[model samples]
Target: HMTNLAESMEADLKVHQKPSPVIVRDALGIFLSILFWSNHRPVQLDNLTEQIKTLEMKPLNLEERLEYVLKRGNTFLGFRQLNELVLEQRKLIAKR
Candidate 1:
């Protein structure tokens, strides 16, 4: 599932010794937005492979990526998963 993407982001932050809580929050927000966006605008099953290549070249930072996601205006794929990710991020932030 895409939840792994959020977990991986947390691990990356830990490894980098990210110093600001703002950065972590921003990162998670961006990630969640992207995950939701993908579900909203799912790639055609027939063209999934080619679509993924284009998605990879998308904006790398939080603000730009989130802005892009917002423009799409689509529904989310998994509300439960998003909630779980929010909790996970909350716990991680609490630990700091």
Candidate 2:
């Protein structure tokens, strides 16, 4: 499923400058779902207000993905963290 998702995202990118929110959401959702099924928590998060939360979908390069997993991927990473990571990934590509 992941392979297929990745492939579909790649195809979308070939047509546009970025991937759609649906793609990112699906990918992340699948990843988190898998993580939940595993013995790990996937990510971590502290207190936060829902009003301050937001979600962004963006295309990801290999480097950004690695950085995200290394820098932000934690057991507490929730929707907000994922959204931030997506925005960061978009910024990284835009700057290039």
Candidate 3:
């Protein structure tokens, strides 16, 4: 499912230069669903958080960053922390 989503998003990017918002939303929704199902497993949650932290080091566009937060941020971060991260990203984008 994640592979298919990535392929679809890549195809959309090839044609539109950016992923459609619907695709981003769907991807985030899928991530959230997986997170929900894995919540009972502490090891899985830690692995996912580590994955997110590693990905966070890569340079991503605003939409990708937003998707990252929506999809993975809540897994390890409180609402306030996530909100702060989003706001900080928005400010950075606005500066550009």
- Ten contiguous residues minimizing lDDT sum, candidate 2: 47-56
Q: Write the per-residue lDDT of candidate 2 for residues 34-96, one digit (tens) a residue.
A: 433332333322321221132122333433453454443332333334545445554644664
Q: lDDT tens string, model 1, 1-96?
A: 335544544454456533244433454455455543544554343543355345432322423334343342121322223334445444544554
**What are the lDDT figures for the candidates, one per model?**
0.41, 0.45, 0.46
Task: Give residue 66's lDDT in candidate 3 (0 to 100).
Answer: 46
Query: Which predicted model would earn the best lDDT?
Result: 3
RMSD over all Cα atoms, model 1: 13.8
Error of 3 at 28 (Å): 0.3
What is the C-alpha local distance difference test score of candidate 2?
0.45
53 in model 2: Cα distance from truth in Å? 20
lDDT of 2 at 81: 48
Count of clashing residue pairs in every prediction: 0, 8, 0
Task: Please give the lDDT score at residue 3 for candidate 2.
Answer: 58
List candidate 2 stretches off by more than 4 Å: 40-96
User: Residue 13 of candidate 1: its Cα lDDT?
Assistant: 47
List the candidate numbers ranked by TM-score, top first.
2, 3, 1
